[model samples]
Target: MSSSNARTQERELTFEEVDAQIQNADLSEFENQDDANAQSLDLAAQLKKVCSVYKVVKPILSLVGNAPFLPSSWKSAVKTFNSVMSTICV
Candidate 1:
């Protein structure tokens, strides 16, 4: 076989090995359901922190976006940002 063809075949084998590893990956792996439950609680606490920050910021953003004489673009951007933040709270 030509050198280029041989090199391509070798690369294919390496890619297949990496693919197998990816196929076996477990994103939320744990030893047992009890461990998974612990992880869930940790994530819930983190989400609560985000919700607290959102509660504090939402009112300020609303006031800025609603103020008279502000540039329309700035108001629109703030409105979009507020909507996005609201979705992440829960």
Candidate 2:
């Protein structure tokens, strides 16, 4: 094999070994209930922000009655925004 090809293979093997070590490590040794609770609280705060936005926008959308296209667009926009927020919360 060429030197570049050999180097690439060596790097791949090294990465695989590191990944295996990480996967096999006893993660529970580093786990902490307090840390988990703090993360949960942070996520709750983000969810509250999304809920507030939904409440504020829904009333505006309701006022735009009889405008089928506009309402459909607003619905789609809200769905997309909520999906993005949910992904970040996770």
Q: How close is candidate 2 to the true structure, as a TM-score?
A: 0.28
Model 1 segments more than 4 A misplaced = 1-45
Q: What alpha-carbon RMSD in Å does predicted model 1 have with respect to the real structure? A: 18.5
Model 1, C-alpha of 59: deviation from truth (Å): 0.9
Which lDDT tens digits does candidate 2 get at residues 1-90? 468645743432343544554565554523454756546667667476545444333333323422456667776776566556545533
Sliding window of 10 residues with minimal summed lDDT for model 2: 57-66
Error (Å) of candidate 2 at residue 54 is 1.5
* Stretches of model 2 off by over 4 angstroms after superposition: 1-41, 64-66, 69-90
The global Cα lDDT (0 to 1) of model 1 is: 0.62
RMSD of each: 18.5, 17.8
Clashes of each: 0, 0
Query: Can you give the lDDT of residue 18 in candidate 2?
Result: 41
| lDDT, candidate 1, 1-90, per-residue tens | 569645743432343544554465553333244746656677777577556656544555666777678999999999899888777764
**Residue 40 in model 1: shift from native, Å?**
15
